[model samples]
Target: MIDWLNSTALTAFGVATTWAEVLGFGTGLLNVGLLVRQHILNWPLGILNVLLLMVVFGAAGLYADMGLQVVYVILGCYGWWAWLHGGADRASLAVRATTGAEWLALAAAGVLLTGGLWLFLDRLTGSTVPLADALTTALSLLATYGQTRKLLENWWLRIAADVIYIPLYGYKGLWLTAILYVAFLTLCVLGLRAWRRAVLA
Candidate 1:
């Protein structure tokens, strides 16, 4: 059990990794931990996780996700600033829920962005799973944007993305990342509950 769990996969590309995966996974866990706690540390840990996962995804031929990491860096910065100063008198941000209209708009945007990215990847890149890649990437962008706005529904979006991410990364031979997403999915649920109570409070 220990060996199977620890073993690295995908040696053909010379990208077989266990420790890097562990480090990245650990950092991601911490990032979400801080997020659940509504602490300020989530941003920096998120940056570190993005950097690490960029290498992981790049090696796995998920170029869209690699690019997504770059976007994550930018969003992380924005989220950091918003969390610090987006409230009254530069206070910490408060949690909020998305309106029905905003939800509809976000759904429309998610679909359009997915289609656009799928076309882009299919035509311009050597992506093996462009549709799945595009869909997850687009959803992740929306979720990240939701987090920056301090929306409680962001965790739902993340959970949605992870549903695809788990199988995608596993198929790509990033077993560790696949495992991490399982952890992430669980955390997303917990985060949703935590933020719900936070909003009520």
Candidate 2:
């Protein structure tokens, strides 16, 4: 029993960095809705998550994702301030869905960004998973922006990305990260339901 416990601890230590990232990602999704609803506590939690994700993605050689975390850090701060002060007479921010035109623009931008990154990284770096990396990176950017704007469709984008991310991370031997994405899939579902209810109610 002692030996089993030791093994478990060792394995956990090996994945400690990824575990932090998982916790952060989970909190981030929850924070997104909370922020959309103008809750004051979302920023700190989001900052914590983005900080951890920066470390994890950097270690994994996901440069774009690492950069995305940096953006998240900035956006998280901006969002915190905006939620608190950018409203009429400094009131809480309200939830607002993205328009169809904006969604199309975002989608087009995602495709262009993904394609551009794929081209550059495929030629400049010797990454084994360039295409998958590019796709996930681009989609994450879109989802993050959508989240910032309180778009109801962000959950759907996250859901689609996680479906691909799970297999990709698993293939790269990032089992813990893959598990996180799997959990993210579940959270996306919950987020969708929760937000839909909020929209209806």
Candidate 3:
């Protein structure tokens, strides 16, 4: 199983990648499905997705994104706990919109983190597409946090990241991952709609 998961198998758009990516892509889609339904199981599936993709991104030299998986693990744990108990009397968190101040804070964090990581990846790491890598990483962090907090806007952030990721990963030769983003983009739209209705409920 380990060998098979770690094995490189497919070639598309002139780039050869691994079975791990294929598995990661499949699980990622599952993760999105669960999130769209507001199911807490998304956290565990997302954790698994991140672990697999970490290897794939590391192999592709997207060091920032490779590191993002670690963040996802931490966020996944937090989201799982929060979804269970981050509410009055240990109730589940409800979907909601972010306030203006909250939006400012999130936007600031994304911008600053993107700039810092871009510089570090450009100057220190062997990363080739530092700008796009850092942007996606930053946006992903915010989006994951938004999901943890049950914010309706998380899906928008993810959708934005997905648009950039499609071409970015494609250019980096992660064809399967790019395709996964396409699927994610579609799911993000649906998640946004579902979560919006959830907010109304």
Candidate 4:
């Protein structure tokens, strides 16, 4: 029974990780836009994808990415609760554009966090491309936080991160994951368009 379970899990993990990444990237594109548009249902779907990707990144030995997944789990929980009760009178959160000041702050924070993480991981873990990896990881965290708050700028951050991640994952031989990011890049464009319409409406 245990062996069967293991076999099942392994097979499911293999197929689901790659396929789910493809599907999940699409969902995530919509999810992030929905988030920025203050749609309540986005949180649940986002959480589901995050949980799945945690296992996938772990198996791939992308430790920074694996750690980022753990962060996503927490962000998912926070996003869920926030979307439900974050607005006035405990209503759903509202869609909001980012202020210029907020954009500056986010950029500064991303740079500092990424730089620090790169230094730590490079020294302790001997990570290849630690700077690039940490930059993506840090920006992603910022984006997730922005998403939970229904901030419009999260899509921009996602677009920037996906640009870097395409080659990074491909270089690492995570071809499927790289492709997923490519798809994610396309989705980001669609998401931007969708959210713009939502905000204008």
On TM-score, the leading prediction is 3
Query: Distance (Å) between predicted and true CA of 49, model 1?
Result: 0.7
lDDT per residue, candidate 2, 1-201, as tens digits? 222211222243254334555555577566655644446787788788777667666667777677778888887777677767765688755556678899889989999989988886788876778888888888887887776666678888888889999998777666666776787788778777776777677
Candidate 1 Cα outliers beyond 4 Å, as residue runs = 1-15
Judge candidate 2 against the unseen true structure and give its global Cα lDDT, from 0 to 1.
0.72
Q: Check candidate 2 and list the clashing pairs.
A: none
| Model 3: colliding residue pairs | none
Off by over 4 Å in 3: 1-4
Q: Could you estimate the TM-score for every candidate?
A: 0.90, 0.80, 0.96, 0.80
Q: What is the Cα-based lDDT of residue 81 in candidate 1?
A: 98
Q: Which RMSD values do the candidates have, in order?
A: 4.9, 5.3, 1.3, 4.1
The order by descending lDDT is: 3, 1, 4, 2
Model 1 global lDDT (CA atoms, 0 to 1): 0.88
Candidate 1: clashing pairs of residues? none
User: Which stretches of model 2 miss by more than 4 angstroms?
Assistant: 1-9, 12-39, 87-90
Q: Compared with the true structure, what per-residue lDDT tens digits does model 1 show for residues 73-124? A: 9999999999999988988789999999989999999989999999999999
CA displacement after TM-score superposition, residue 148 of candidate 1 (Å): 1.0
Window of ten residues with lowest summed lDDT in model 2: 1-10
Please give, for residues 10-120, the per-residue lDDT of candidate 4 as tens digits. Answer: 222234335444555566666655654456777777877676565555555566877887888888889889878988899977767898998899989988999888887
lDDT of 3 by residue, 1-201 (tens): 656766778776776768889889999999999999999899999999999998888778999999999999999999999999997799999999989999999989998999999999999998889999999999999999999999999999999999999999878878889999999999999999999998887
Clashes of each: 0, 0, 0, 0
